[model samples]
Target: MKVMNCPLNGPRNISEFAWGGEVKPMPDPAGVGDKEWAAWLFLEANEAGVVREWWCHVPTSYWFIAERNNITDEIIKTYPATEVFNTRVEFAAKAGAGEKK
Candidate 1:
């Protein structure tokens, strides 16, 4: 059976986890253009060899990072997302969404 080590929950079955996506720089939600935002959300580098990706432990709802070899499908390492993302991203509230016209 395949297994993956979750940063918070220790070793677990691979089926208990979910592959979120390839880790990439997120564009500014307010400042970025629509096309650019769409590209960032939909497109991926899809490169071969080792790549960093976001993964989630389904049972615990814990998110983390994983370095894996896409070509051979081997997980090189796994760690908490906090190791890389040190800051929390706060989004500004939309203008006049709740106010009466």
Candidate 2:
């Protein structure tokens, strides 16, 4: 059984958590067309690499972000949702610089 570190609950069984899907930057909902909104809502990149995702602790109903490598199934870190904006910004900056974190 895999164990995941929950930001609020420390380490716990992976079964106690729910996969909340990938974390992507939100586009301005007001400016996007229906097609764009639909794509955003339904489509997933499913990239084969390190990706940041949202995970919810089912028992406590706490949601947090986890940076994991899809290929290896290794979780690098878990953090609160409040830190997501900064994490996304940092990830974007690294990508823009042609660097991987």
Candidate 3:
């Protein structure tokens, strides 16, 4: 069984965590075309070397980042999401846009 180090909870069973997805930069939606938006939503590098991704501790609902090797499935390091995703970008709803109640 694989073990993953949780930034907040320490080391734990891999089953206790969820793979959130690869960590990537969010594109500026207003300046990009539909194709770019679609790619961002659907595509992943899926590279064979070390890749950075997001993982969540199921019990605590805590999310963090992990750097692991895709080929060997070895976790290199883990850190809080804030360390990498420090900038928060807020997208304002445009006029006439449907808002969720």
Candidate 4:
């Protein structure tokens, strides 16, 4: 069983959660052609490596963001489930490693 460390609530049970969609710019619901709209609806980005995502707390009815390495199921970070995801990006930029973003 893998453990995920959350920002607000640390070390949550993975089973008590649900996987949401990709944390990215979704397609514009308006101002698009038929083909573009269909593509957006069907196609999605499954980015490798450090992929940011949303998750729902099934047991608690809470939502949050998770920074996880998809291939390994290694959760790197977590944040409160919010519409504006700028907080997650800001935190990542500050927590620097060998290189900077």
Among these predicted structures, which one has the highest TM-score?
Answer: 1
Kindly give the number of clashing pairs for every candidate: 0, 0, 0, 0
User: Stretches of candidate 3 above 4 Å error?
Assistant: 99-101
- Evaluated with lDDT, which candidate comes out highest? 1
Q: Over 4 Å off in model 2, which ranges?
A: 86-101
* lDDT by residue for model 3 (1-101), tens: 88999999999999999998899988996787889988988899898899999899999999999999989999999999999877878887777789665
> Which runs in model 4 stand beyond 4 Å of their true positions?
6-9, 83-101
Residue by residue across 20-87, what tens digits does model 4's lDDT show?
77766654444567898777666658878888788887767777888889888788888775645544
TM-score of each model, paired residue for residue: 0.91, 0.81, 0.90, 0.65
Candidate with better lDDT, 1 vs 4: 1
- The RMSD (Cα, Å) of candidate 1 is 1.4
User: Which candidate, 1 or 3, has the higher lDDT?
Assistant: 1
Ranked by TM-score, top first? 1, 3, 2, 4
lDDT of 3 at 98: 98
Decoy 4 TM-score against native: 0.65
Residue 69 lDDT, candidate 1, scale 0-100:
98
- The window of 10 residues in a row where model 2 has the poorest summed lDDT is 86-95
For every candidate, C-alpha RMSD to the true structure in Å:
1.4, 12.0, 2.2, 13.9
Q: Each candidate's lDDT (Cα)?
A: 0.93, 0.87, 0.92, 0.71
